[model samples]
Target chain A: MAVDEGLKIELGKQGVFVTTIEELYNWGRRSSIWPMQFGLACCAIEMIATTMARYDLARFGAEVFRPSPRQADLMIISGTVTKKMAPQVVRLYNQMAEPRYVIAMGACAISGGPFKQGYNVLKGIDRYIPVDVHIPGCPPRPEALLQAFMTLQKKIDGQPLTGPDRPRFLDAEAQGEFPVPVQGEHDLEPTSNPGVWTVPVVIR
Target chain B: MASSPYFSLAVLFVAALGFGLTPLGLAWLWGRVFSPAKPNAVKNAIYECGLESRGDAWMQFRSAYYLYAIIFLIFDVEAVFLLPFAVAFTGLGAAACVAMLVFVLMLIEGLAWAWAKGVLTWA
Candidate 1:
């Protein structure tokens, strides 16, 4: 019933489709990427606008946003990740089922934006979890996020599961978990630093 | 014993339930088979808006709400009793009228007592 305009004449004899196993697999995975229904700060407003009637993120088949991290495969770090919230963010990232992705949406999520020198702000979410796409803006417009989605889809299409040098998420269950940060005197630390964790016992 | 009409109803109910549950079951199966689920300590921890939860949630609640709930119950029960009286009003005799009058008077008395006690005022 439906056909591509350019390919109409080319497939006049036989409209039968053909594709390799990997292509089919990649297409299925990239199409229905369910992002987490999570937000941190102001940039979240723009993220929400992208899903509304005007932008209609559902057109690309990625409208389902799961509240639970276990259900979501895409994480959009929409705003600045504060030091106090680092542990919980890492924890959330670890819970996401593979093949999972992280999109550092907006400059705040990418590198703390204008709050780069703030005492409470984490430099970037990448300090803990690996990022897939980085969209740079103090608070990127809805169009920018849509562009990020396109870029991420393209990235997903390139990954193959059969090769030796395959991406980490190629084997759905092979993703390494990021260490949850621990509270330190000045800021949260990923490692069990003796300077932070070990209490100096008072001796007589 | 099973009959044709009841059997038809059972079949319809079963079809409805199946329609509702099939999609949910398939989704769960697909997620279980295709999605990887490996949880650790931090990943499994309760979410509290991206921060660790503070002190115990339970604390002593204010007693003023108790009076409000009790007042609501009195009026709610009064409406339940009044329903039968209103339904049988045209068929009732003088004796029933007297009894209904007494019942309304008692309710009015209770309301007056609560009003006198300043229970109606917001503290």
Candidate 2:
């Protein structure tokens, strides 16, 4: 028994515990997220407001606003993305490392809000890049953002790699109305396609 | 019988250099004390306004720009020299005032030459 205990101690001294120690460290790092200090439009103001004294996002261990994308793990797509700006946003998303998560923070990001009819705005950000979570509101209240953070925490715990029904929105699928992609200038313009069915044909 | 203009300028230059270095030196010392130990790879990078840096730092600018910039700097220095003299002209008496008038005429001649060269036109 004394010899067995001595052998265990020797193995521990030889860096046998390094992997276990690193795993524990990684877990702690992932749990307390340091969001990147990035914002596109109006929703970004609300995101900043969340960090202020009133809402105090620091309580959730996510107050560190890293300016560098390489150092950050979470990206909050907080506003309407125009077609010109879409590619830049996609490039920024791709620059972030894998196991990174995104929080689509507004009705604009989730479904382009009122700008869906506009030619410049993207119908939805998800069309450009994969979204892990969607927080549906014109500009969600800070408390709603706090709730979304809790939802994301639940997602991290669940660890689902790929699935259609991963994130549960408040009004899932935008109050039963599916988002239609704006194809071009003519597509958004008022058309008299009386024969065309209202039922959306999901493009494969 | 009196101190030279060159002697007064030397004193101003030394005082200006001392004032400029004070803030720079304090910032350097403060950074050394509080900054984290820069791991070898991450520390040496040249950050170009947040974007990743690429290519050589030895960038070449157009010669047209250099010519225009030199002209601007010469005029700027002339203004700096003339402002203080203008403020003190009342006390300087006749001989010093006449010397400054000659300097102004020379500056005007230089400006006319530049204008004739078409460098004064907004490109």
Candidate 3:
């Protein structure tokens, strides 16, 4: 059962903490989001800066950047997702443990940015894997990365632990593996994952 | 049994074990109930560095490398021990000197064995 905010505040005033299982679960999950340590391009420099002293991301409890996808809770796709690199990126995302989140940092990752017309660049990473937050900019400042991280934390906090609206990881029926795209004769075979992304219809 | 000297130690030991095991038990129970296992080929793969791992991790090495290992012990390990022994030589007792001598002799004997076996000869 959900506790009334007013009642919870009153309990806190009386030195007693009031919480539900969902709140406690979400709080713990959102607090310790360890991002995978791989970086794509120039935007990766900003990602590194976000974890460094001045913009210290540890304040949000996401400082630990795990080298292995197995230990990571978040994947910060910081930079351009070239067609050549896209397969490896999707594979890394697929290897990540359940309850993982992705932050498509910078315009390059969200869209191909300046390289949109280029033959090699992948339009966006979200075409293959789902993204939780998108931070726009050629290479967004450390502040932008920090903001995206907070947005992800908010998203995590609001997720229901049970019932129909619960997050994908909690749902046993949810798709387990995001298919790792392969390098075909021309471009990435299958283009995009049908499960996560659909062809954006053009207006006449 | 309550009045026995070891009774308190038993209680403390139980408490220490409970301290460690309680959280582990709770985590296992929580995982079973909330997070269902969703293992797949990609997620269960041995290598985590994105690239597909090729071939078996089990590979054979040459048995002749044992001679190099012995030689390394004689040269590298001997220098490490000898430096400390030399530095403290002035304050060492006759017994300590004898111990150092025995250690040096054992390393020399290994070198001698390797030399006699033609390990020092470059093919």
Candidate 4:
């Protein structure tokens, strides 16, 4: 009936196709991931450089960096997270539409790097948000970021589209929104945490 | 009614809504069901360059940019009106030609006025 079909018959091949929806879904998800363009410190510069022509992140289909969290699929925490800025970071993450990802792009974002001891610096962004990939470096080189993208793509390929254990965004009811941190006199604290400013509620 | 020609508009309107919402809804559904939800105090907080914001983010901005936009709008309107006239020039009469010339001259006069008033200058 068709040229390819005739060749297939001549080769003695059966054309029965077999695949689950999850595999297809995962394939699509792994291809195009839009990352949030916002960045914090020195690592942000490297992140921008990765998207430029030299490194060319567009080849991996992740070059489109969205300014708005609602449109972004990935959040590359590109710098140190401070106590005051922690709440803001979480807020941005929460604002992002589902099927989102997070990649800690540098030593500062991973564990505060050299600034870990600083009074204002957060020890690690993982303390605030769930990081999917951690790219370890003072400011991870563009090449390293490319490697991280490959790793993340591999992880995305393993995900299932539908099942008893589907993505949190698809579950809807199980979807958790991070609580906005309240700015305290000395430091920032989660409002949901016990006894932020006042005394803890005591039951006699 | 479905028989009406305006029915196409209704279909388009509904299709537009579906087009915009489907991708967003699908993405949200996928993320919520599959992605892990491990939010804490720090995770939920706002991000501001890894530091505590000292004051309110609101600040006064200069309104001088509006003058430039107004000037651009004037030229934009001129082009919009002139583009059709330019394409239809061979079919136009002398009266129409004179009318367009007068219209263009008025805009040039306005430009001259703006130049005289120093609106063209950045200072």
- Considering only chain A, what is the TM-score of each predicted structure? 0.85, 0.67, 0.98, 0.82
Name the runs in model 1 displaced over 4 angstroms.
A1-13, A171-175, A191-204, B1-37, B44-68, B71-123
Q: In what order do the candidates fall by lDDT, top score first?
A: 3, 1, 4, 2
Model 3 lDDT per residue over A54-149, tens place: 999999999999999999999999999999899889889889988999999999999899999999999999999999999999899999999998
| Of 1 and 4, the candidate ranking higher by DockQ | 1
Say which candidate scores most in DockQ. 3
Give the range where candidate 4 chain A is weakest over 10 consecutive residues by summed lDDT. Answer: A191-200
- Candidate 2: which pairs clash? none
Candidate 2: lDDT of A136? Answer: 89
Looking at model 2 chain B, report the run of 10 residues with the lowest lDDT sum: B34-43
Candidate 2 Cα outliers beyond 4 Å, as residue runs? A1-27, A30-32, A52-61, A157-204, B1-60, B74-112
lDDT of 4 at B71: 78
Could you tell me the lDDT of residue A3 within candidate 3?
84
- Single out the weakest 10-residue window by summed lDDT for candidate 3 chain A: A85-94
- Computed on C-alphas against the true complex, the DockQ of each candidate is 0.26, 0.03, 0.61, 0.11
Q: Pick the candidate with the highest TM-score.
A: 3
Model 1, A66: alpha-carbon shift in Å?
A: 1.6
lDDT of 1 at A66: 90
DockQ of 3: 0.61
Provide the TM-score for each candidate, comma-separated: 0.67, 0.53, 0.82, 0.59
The pairs that clash in candidate 1 are none
Encode model 4's per-residue lDDT on A7-117: one tens digit a residue: 556555566544456766777777889999888999999999999999999999999998877678999999988786777787888777667899998998888899989
Worst 10 residues of 2 chain A by lDDT: A170-179
Model 1 chain B: ten consecutive residues of lowest lDDT = B43-52
